[model samples]
Target chain A: MNTLMRWIGIAVVIFIAAPLVIVVPMSFSTAASLQFPPPGYSWGYYQQFFSDPSWLRPAWNSIYIATMNTLLTMALVVPATFALVRHKFWGKSFANLMMMMPMAVPHIVMAVGYYSYFGELKLVHSKLGVILAHSCLSVPITFLVLSANLKGFDLTLERAARSLGATPGQVFRHITLPILKPGLAISALFAFIQSFDETVVAIFISGRDAETLPRKMFDSIREEADPVIAVISTLLFAVVFAGLIAPSLIKGLRRMAGGTPSK
Target chain B: MSAYLRLAGVNKTFGNFTALGHIDLEVEKGEFVTFLGPSGSGKTTTLMVIAGFEKATRGEITVADQSLAHLAPQERNIGIVFQNYALFPHKTAAENVYFPLQMRKVGKKEGMKKAAEMLDLVGLKGFAHRLPKELSGGQQQRVALARALVFEPDLLLLDEPLGALDKNLREQMQIEIKRIQKRLGVTTIFVTHDQTEAMSMSDRIVVFSNGAIEQAAAPLDIYHRPATRFVADFIGESNLLEATITDAATGKAHSPVLGEVTCGAEGLPPLTDGQAVSLLIRPEHLKLSREPKEGRQNAQMVIETIVNYGDNAVVIGHAGDQQIRVRVPGADVVILKEGDSCHFSWTADAVFVLDK
Candidate 1:
């Protein structure tokens, strides 16, 4: 059947990605040179990563900045996307066009613009400056996902809410927010990844104090050039894997908790 | 209020095309007024205006003598039912019914109590916890009706609420709606293009044509004495006869081929002698006989064709130069056959002079 062939194609893709998982243990190399199926698994590199102030400091900074950037981006993106979806007005197309601009242009191109803009504003090297750059890069993804979720929504609920005597704000808080749960989770997850995995924008905007995890990983590759990069990538791959699997698991649990859809 | 809702000089223009114009209607506190017309006749537009979902370009609307122009749809205290039912797919039948009460800040216990009463009123007592999709078309419509009535709105506007049901269910829902609307006695404005639905349920019907009220009257009057040719043709099956005013000799006008007709319509408008005008005659009103009547002067025509629809018969024939159809009660064994001669006669008052 056609369905079986599609599943076979998916299996082929997973089969292709199988050997790449070997890269995870390569960071344990006891020797100075990088080798796959690491020569001897040792706790030395991980011990170096945990105890040494040098290795731990930038890693902490990168995690904090990316987390903060994701939060800030969601704050702006959620309301902007809601307004775009709910109302009809002049220049609506223009607003949608503007929101999509940063995603369509390459991140490196925007990174150059951000670098010069921040430099002239004297904000370069600050944590806030790097956060601003990351927020900009993640916003398009968040807005697009949230907006698509909102457009197909039945607007009569809002009308019914208003007629019921809820103020517009109460309707938005209670009804709109409840219905938007799935989309919110999806958008927040995507936006977090976009900021956390950003390298090009971080390289251009970050100073020594504002370096993110991906930027630090890039610097580590340049200096030592070993399989430690693979360890970090595998760690990130785990996070992405968690995000991808969580939706289905949560949905399954919800389905089990509830019965089938009633007539 | 004497009249629960009233509209005057209403005009609506979507871009350059006028969707509704110069509409006037008054629905009494407990009366059921229907907007009946074909598609694009502004029935839905008029409903939207009354619901406060649309603004009129120039008009006045008063619900219970309160001006509705500045009020929002929620503030208007009106209930709406759409063609699709618009039930919350996520909410159970009981929960959907209770939505409006919750909006008004009613306590949950009281809201649920009232919602259950409404669900029972609609005869969906045991299926209260089921979602909309779980119900049949008729049950879904009952849910929609329950949701609308639970709020006890000042006016209930139904936009073709029974349109999606099959014929049998649609007929059943018609009676159900009529019973419910009468029981509630809430002012109702029901809109539809289905003339049978309008005739069966409406206290008064407003026939719409091209953004204007063609005729607004009781169902029988609108059918028997339509003010326009459009109304006669639209509301029921009518045979339009292009007849000349051959003589106003008896101090009354005689419409040709329509037997010998006399109207107390003294002025006769400007239709002079030999001027062709349309005469509206309902098909069912034509009395067809095989034998010539003793004292009745009737127009004789040969039966051209007979369509035998079970329970009724449509006898198409040529009367003079005009083709006409006569409907008689004969879905059973029809005595009339093609190529046979038949005599047709109608009462003096049955012929309606169309304003053409």
Candidate 2:
């Protein structure tokens, strides 16, 4: 039974990691097109991805749109989460449902809706259109993260601050914002990742001028099987993996240096 | 001199549910008062109203002859130490203490120096840089105390600050808090349901029941001379026997369980003849003996349980249908046994009457 269970675990891990194993190696392949095995390893695709204006412009566009989406999403979600988590009023349940509506509906359906809706607003094929759509899509997960943090926040701290002579605005600046910094960072990261990786909505609204990286990758894959797509995937995976482990890596290095961790 | 902090007919209601019902209280300057009651009895609610968190539906609070009506909590200049400590996790001990001063726009260097001095006063001298989670529970409690006091606010309200600590640590912090409050001479209000904490710390204790103040007096007075049956029963372990005053002049009362009893304790309320009242006999005041003792109010009962502490023991038994508890010295426990018929006696001086 133990052997069978161990085998099952190994199979599950392999199935989950198969994409990374394939994409990472294919990224370094010297093949002219997307192919595996019999292809020699080189940095040719990585060089092309960095040097090509076609790849670089969309990458920069994705970054800009994602950054704007994050800012706009946080601006909308922060206060909404605080209200929904901390207060109750008429139609509160409906408001809560509306906040999570984007997550419930299919992404393709949302893409189609925005494609026409933004077209009428004369915003389609513009960076503003993609940013606005991504912000709406980012709301649910961002709200979930922020509301969970807000709920766990001991309100007594705010009360304590007030008693200690901090005005309402001062309390937020000195106590609430500082304490919620980590949660806010994580939620904003989620928003950025969601916008940067959103393909369907970007393909619909982000036309030639405002094309995001994911839409560009999709177009390129359909037109020609570009190995550069694998390079981009590999680079994004490395960046995200580094971000996830950076905190512990820094802590470990500090420990090795005989410096105390700041809890 | 006028009272330092005063609440005149303060009442709070949440829709239909009354949280505080016509609370009128006065605390002299530099005096330590405690609001003692069970959960939902509105002790904390009164504190919140005073702190401006829960606005009173009616009535007003004044400190130093100034009405706190239009003042926000920040303008009121009151310090509070919460039950959970509520220390800023991101700030060090010194920084936490410096927060109030920073709000007053004190410079960083000077505020930090003052904060360190305050931390030193709380016996956390060298822990200025430690985060709250890095310190022990008692240390966190001291940091909270220092932070609350560093601003030198007009009032300090501690909401059951020692409730989360272990017994030994709780006792230690109690003494520590009392010492700090004394040194600072801040008019402090500590809230707790723990009767012993209220008894040991407060210059005066305001006992709450339901939504009103049952009685407010010095600790011993509140304990020995509780104004109502609820105060008698809640403050300490007591055998509250239902009785009727038979002679108002002689302090005599008749009880179904203990028969005729004389309530001659000093400071007892004036009783009228045929008045329905309760005779409160604290368990420690009752003496357990094998035979009916002479010149004392004696009652016979069958011993059912003996709960032994290290230095003392409580002998619980029944007389007719009423349960009687008698606290005896640990040395006397060997002479008593369960199922043995025993006599519990109290003198006239120990028998206090509650006419409520």
Q: Write the per-residue lDDT of candidate 1 for residues B1-356, one digit (tens) a residue.
A: 57778898999999999999799888889899999998999999999888877899999999878899998777788888888887877778998899889888889899999999999999999888888888887898999899989989999989998889999999999999999999999889999999999999999999999999999999987887788888978978888876666674542345556555654353245556665667777888777887766644468888898888878888899877777788888743267779888888765556667656
Q: lDDT tens string, model 1, A1-263?
A: 99999999999988977756666677666756567667788867667667766556667877788789889988999888877987888999999898888889998999899888999998898889888888888888999899889987788767656655567787787677887888888888788778878889888888788877788778878888656566666666777788789878988887788854533
Question: Which stretch of 10 consecutive residues in model 2 chain A shows the poorest summed lDDT?
Answer: A254-263
Error of 1 at B179 (Å): 1.9
Off by over 4 Å in 2: A1-11, A253-263
What DockQ, on C-alphas, does every prediction get?
A: 0.34, 0.72
Off by over 4 Å in 1: A1-12, A15-62, A82-92, A222-228, A254-263, B14-17, B133-136, B249-276, B286-308, B313-323, B328-350
TM for candidate 2 is: 0.96
| lDDT of candidate 2 at residue B203, scale 0 to 100 | 99
Predicted candidate 1, C-alpha RMSD: 4.1
Model 2: pairs clashing at backbone N, Cα or C within 3 Å = none
